[model samples]
Target: MIRKLEGRTWKFGDNINTDLMIPSFALAEPEEKQPKYCFSANRPGWVDLVKPGDILVAGNNFGTGSSRPGAKVLKSLGIICLLAESINGLFLRNCVNYGLPALPCPGVFSSFNEGDIASVQLEEGKVVNLNSGRVLATTALPNMLLEILAAGGIVPLLEGKGLLDKAR
Candidate 1:
């Protein structure tokens, strides 16, 4: 898996649910077009400002809502990884399934301001603020999850092992 990620941070508050990331209306749009609508309701014009390799830092209960493929949209929008004070369990799985690394660091919300550079080491469960030289410990992902991420998600992992039919 990708062991490390360093990127500019995008700070968000608590309860950043699936609806905010990918509105119900956006889901009906083409997959490639859906990302443009991310955070459109709450952070108008924010999606346009996001750059590839950016990291999202959020407060508690991040991604707490319906299973609407929000994680896929975030990855498509170029967010390489997510650091949050807390992440909803279902959403966390979705993130992994979509090949987006997400970690929960208890104090992550206050660690950086928007635009600060942050570095994350997934397996090590470490987060560092490159701008401030502050380090935070995160909940490490499991080895199996890391393997799935390395293969670009569970489907690919299974396919590689010949456990899934490619035709399907």
Candidate 2:
């Protein structure tokens, strides 16, 4: 259920739209190539800079644009989760659908700096700054959502239920 997520934080500011997440020109490319262009237009070389298990921390309205396939790109890049001051509803849903959890926490932006290691405990709804000893609370993930995430996304959950193979 992704009870504990720990990683270095990659901070970004407000209103980072889908285009900035993965530019439209790179949309058609395969997963192997899609990550290279992620944040390329906004933060050049960001993809190469991120390591596996890294957490993305952002300001208000993160992922505030057209609902697109950017979450898939993020998952493929190995981002474990996202903690933000606020996030667009569609984008949050998309991230969850792709098995990348995104949670809103007030003051999260003000609490941690870029590159500070952060640990999120989903069950406790707590985010801790491993570097500074600050902690913040967020909404607890619902059990159903946790189940989907544990399965690595909705498709996998459905597959586990034999729903994907059966005609609806």
Candidate 3:
């Protein structure tokens, strides 16, 4: 379901853990307000500057930390999608559960400079080089999570299907 997310690209090297995504201390705050304070502990000003549909590309190991179930920060940060060389399996699962598409497409970091336009196809596992119009690298997104993503987050779809009757 992923395609071209048109916006500025923020580039990072590697080992971008959850601490750099959203600090643990901020987890106490409500989810909607988290984005305004995202990564403020490490990068300070980058999150506030992020515009909707902007893509984040990192070399490897993006979002490796305690599984904090909040994509609200990432969502509010206006990140359309994340392309990384690699990602923590737990983060991958937790993120998508909250409606975040954490994809893996290695080599894009090497090919693209900051601000280069790119496109990600979840079905193909290929990130197209919009600048050069070439394919990047193939990767995998877990099958179960893909299903959840297709449903536009787990709870909403469940509620729509009348599968969340437990709350009532």
Candidate 4:
């Protein structure tokens, strides 16, 4: 898995739905073409501005809407990970399946700001504010999920273990 993640933070608030991440209008396009629409509705020009490996920190209930395409879009946009106070279960599953690390850090949203340098140690559940030297604790990622991420997603994970062929 991505044990250590270091990047500039892109802060967001609570209840940021999938609609805001990847609007419905963008879903019909191909995956390679979807990144351009990520956060276009909520944060105009976000796709053009966000850099690869940038960390997204948010408040409670991040990714609350019923849309899976947003996760794919965010992954395509090169979002390294998501640190939120709480994340919707379905969205979190989507993130994991897409090889995107999503962690629950209680104080992350308030402790950091947009453009703040941040780093996360997944196994240790440590979140650090590289800009101000602040530290926060997060829920440790489960080993199974870590394995999935390490293999680059669920499909790859299954393929590595020869499970896909057997299932087929």
Among these predictions, the greatest lDDT belongs to: 1
Q: Please, what's the RMSD in Å of model 2?
A: 2.0
How far in Å is the alpha carbon of 164 misplaced in model 3? 1.9
Comparing 3 and 4 by lDDT, which wins?
4
- Among residues 3 or more apart in sequence or in different chains, the pairs in candidate 4 whose N, CA or C atoms overlap within 3 Å are none
Q: Judge candidate 4 against the unseen true structure and give its global Cα lDDT, from 0 to 1.
A: 0.85
**Model 2 regions more than 4 Å off:** 166-168
TM-score of 2: 0.93
lDDT of 2 at 146: 74
lDDT tens per residue, model 3, 86-156: 87787777668777777877677887788887777776676776787777768657777777877777888
> Candidate 4: misplaced stretches above 4 Å?
165-168
Q: lDDT tens string, model 1, 79-162?
A: 999999999999999999998999989998888989999999999999999999999986698898887787888777777889
TM-score of each predicted structure versus truth: 0.95, 0.93, 0.86, 0.92
Question: Least accurate stretch of 10 residues (summed lDDT) in model 2?
Answer: 159-168
Stretches of candidate 1 above 4 Å error? none
Which of candidates 1 and 3 reaches a greater TM-score?
1
Ordered by TM-score, highest first, the candidates read: 1, 2, 4, 3
Ten residues in a row with the worst lDDT in model 4?
67-76
Model number with the top TM-score: 1
